[model samples]
Target: QEELAKKQAEALKIQKKNDELRAREEQRHLAKNTRVFELPLSRYKRKDDLKDIAACLGLDLNGKIPELTSRIKAHLDSNSVLQANPRFCGLFG
Candidate 1:
């Protein structure tokens, strides 16, 4: 009976640990999902187009395509004046 009690205690400890880990993982997933980003620019049909978009967004040319696109979207979202610009709107929207 003593051994059974010890085993039950161990099991309870492991179960509690597992529950904590699950909760932490769920929190991480929720945080990731809640993050807001956007893809402002479409695909580049030419290399020059890619350069122009990066220049216009003030993002580094070395950044990945998706990251640059997201930054551009965020910029446009924050700056209504940029959104109002005909050239900027034509390129991104």
Candidate 2:
């Protein structure tokens, strides 16, 4: 009975150590893959700056800006041409 208890205690310790190692490895992997950006859009001088940033992050910026801008203006204008609105407001909002 004593030998069986000793074996069970050793197994528990080994399992605990393995769990700790796995957690540490996962934390390191997450830190390596995560990215954070800190900047206000108003700080950018031109629309191309946004595209360049996206490109640097391995994102496809082609045609996305035009589509996004048009969609936003369409929403704000309610599909009417009579409304006078800013072209870059949608980009910032």
Instruction: Please name the candidate that would achieve the greatest TM-score relative to the true structure.
Output: 1
The root-mean-square deviation over C-alpha atoms between each candidate and the true structure, in angstroms, is: 14.4, 15.6
Q: Rate the local accuracy (lDDT) of all candidates.
A: 0.59, 0.49
lDDT of 2 at 45: 48
lDDT tens digits by residue: candidate 2, 2-51:
99999999999999999997885565445433423234334544445554
lDDT of 1: 0.59
Q: Please identify model 1 stretches exceeding 4 Å from their true place.
A: 1-40, 43-48
Q: After superposition, how far is residue 89 of candidate 1 from its true place, in Å?
A: 1.5
lDDT of 2: 0.49
lDDT of 1 at 34: 36
Residues 1-93, model 1: lDDT tens digits: 999999999999999999997885565455442332233466454444454555655556456666666666677678778656655665454
Q: Which ten residues in a row have the lowest lDDT in candidate 1?
A: 31-40
lDDT leader: 1
